[model samples]
Target: MRASPADIESICLSLPEVELGISWGDRPTYKVPRGAKGRGFLLYRAPGKTAIDPVSGDMFTDLLVIQVADEMTKRTLVQDPQSPFFTIDHFNGYNAVLVQESRLGELERDQLVEIIADAWATKAPPRLVREYFANR
Candidate 1:
């Protein structure tokens, strides 16, 4: 089954030290309480002028911006033909991938959990990361 926005929020909040916040007024954002300026790991994106549907020319409202460990990770996901993850011009030079909510069925629930956990680890402090891994 496809994941919903509520599912995303629940997964994000499941990570250690994750806090919910709003960005751009209402878009949901998840952050780790560590790192410079409190690292944001995930965001619900509303496509701006830079990101639009090629066929319909409409902005994507059900988009997610998920932070990856690095450019390589982002590239791998976006470049894979089977991956639901993609990127737009707005995300150039950024270590993140965009996924459509409606297309989330492309990934299994456990896969989604791993992605979110990896994202949290990228933003989470070493101590927290160590603790998380030790528990697992």
Candidate 2:
């Protein structure tokens, strides 16, 4: 089954202390509280020259940027040729992966949940992360 944008929003908001914030003008961003600051864990990316479809040479209009714990985690997600996760030159050296909203169906709903939850853990306070995992 295909996961929709609504599914993404729902999964992000379900995490502990997550907040919906507007970023890059009007794009939706999910952030987790850390002390006095809220760190973004996931966001809808705006189409630009950075990320484009090689085949069509067109900017991707429906991309989602999801944070990861480290470069290893980012590589693991995007290294698989069949994985919908990917990265562009603009994101090199960044601990995140980009996936088109349209390709979300390539992952199972549970898989989607796991990734989003993982993204949350990456930006969530250490105590919150420990508590969240401890309860689970």
Top-TM-score structure, candidate number: 2
lDDT of 2 by residue, 1-136 (tens): 6566669878887788989886667887898883348888899899999999999999999999999989999899999988899999899988999999998888888889988999999989999999988987
- Candidate 1 per-residue lDDT, tens place, 11-47, comes to 8888888887766678878989733366788988876
Residue 13 of candidate 1: its Cα lDDT? Answer: 82
| Model 2 ranges off by over 4 Å | 24-26, 34-36
TM-score of each: 0.89, 0.92
TM-score, candidate 2, is 0.92
Clashing residue pairs in candidate 1 (N, C-alpha, C atoms within 3 angstroms): none
Task: State the TM-score for model 1.
Answer: 0.89
Root-mean-square deviation (CA) per prediction: 2.3, 1.8
Model 2, residue 82: distance off in Å is 2.0
Off by over 4 Å in 1: 1-4, 24-26, 34-37
Clashes of 1: 0
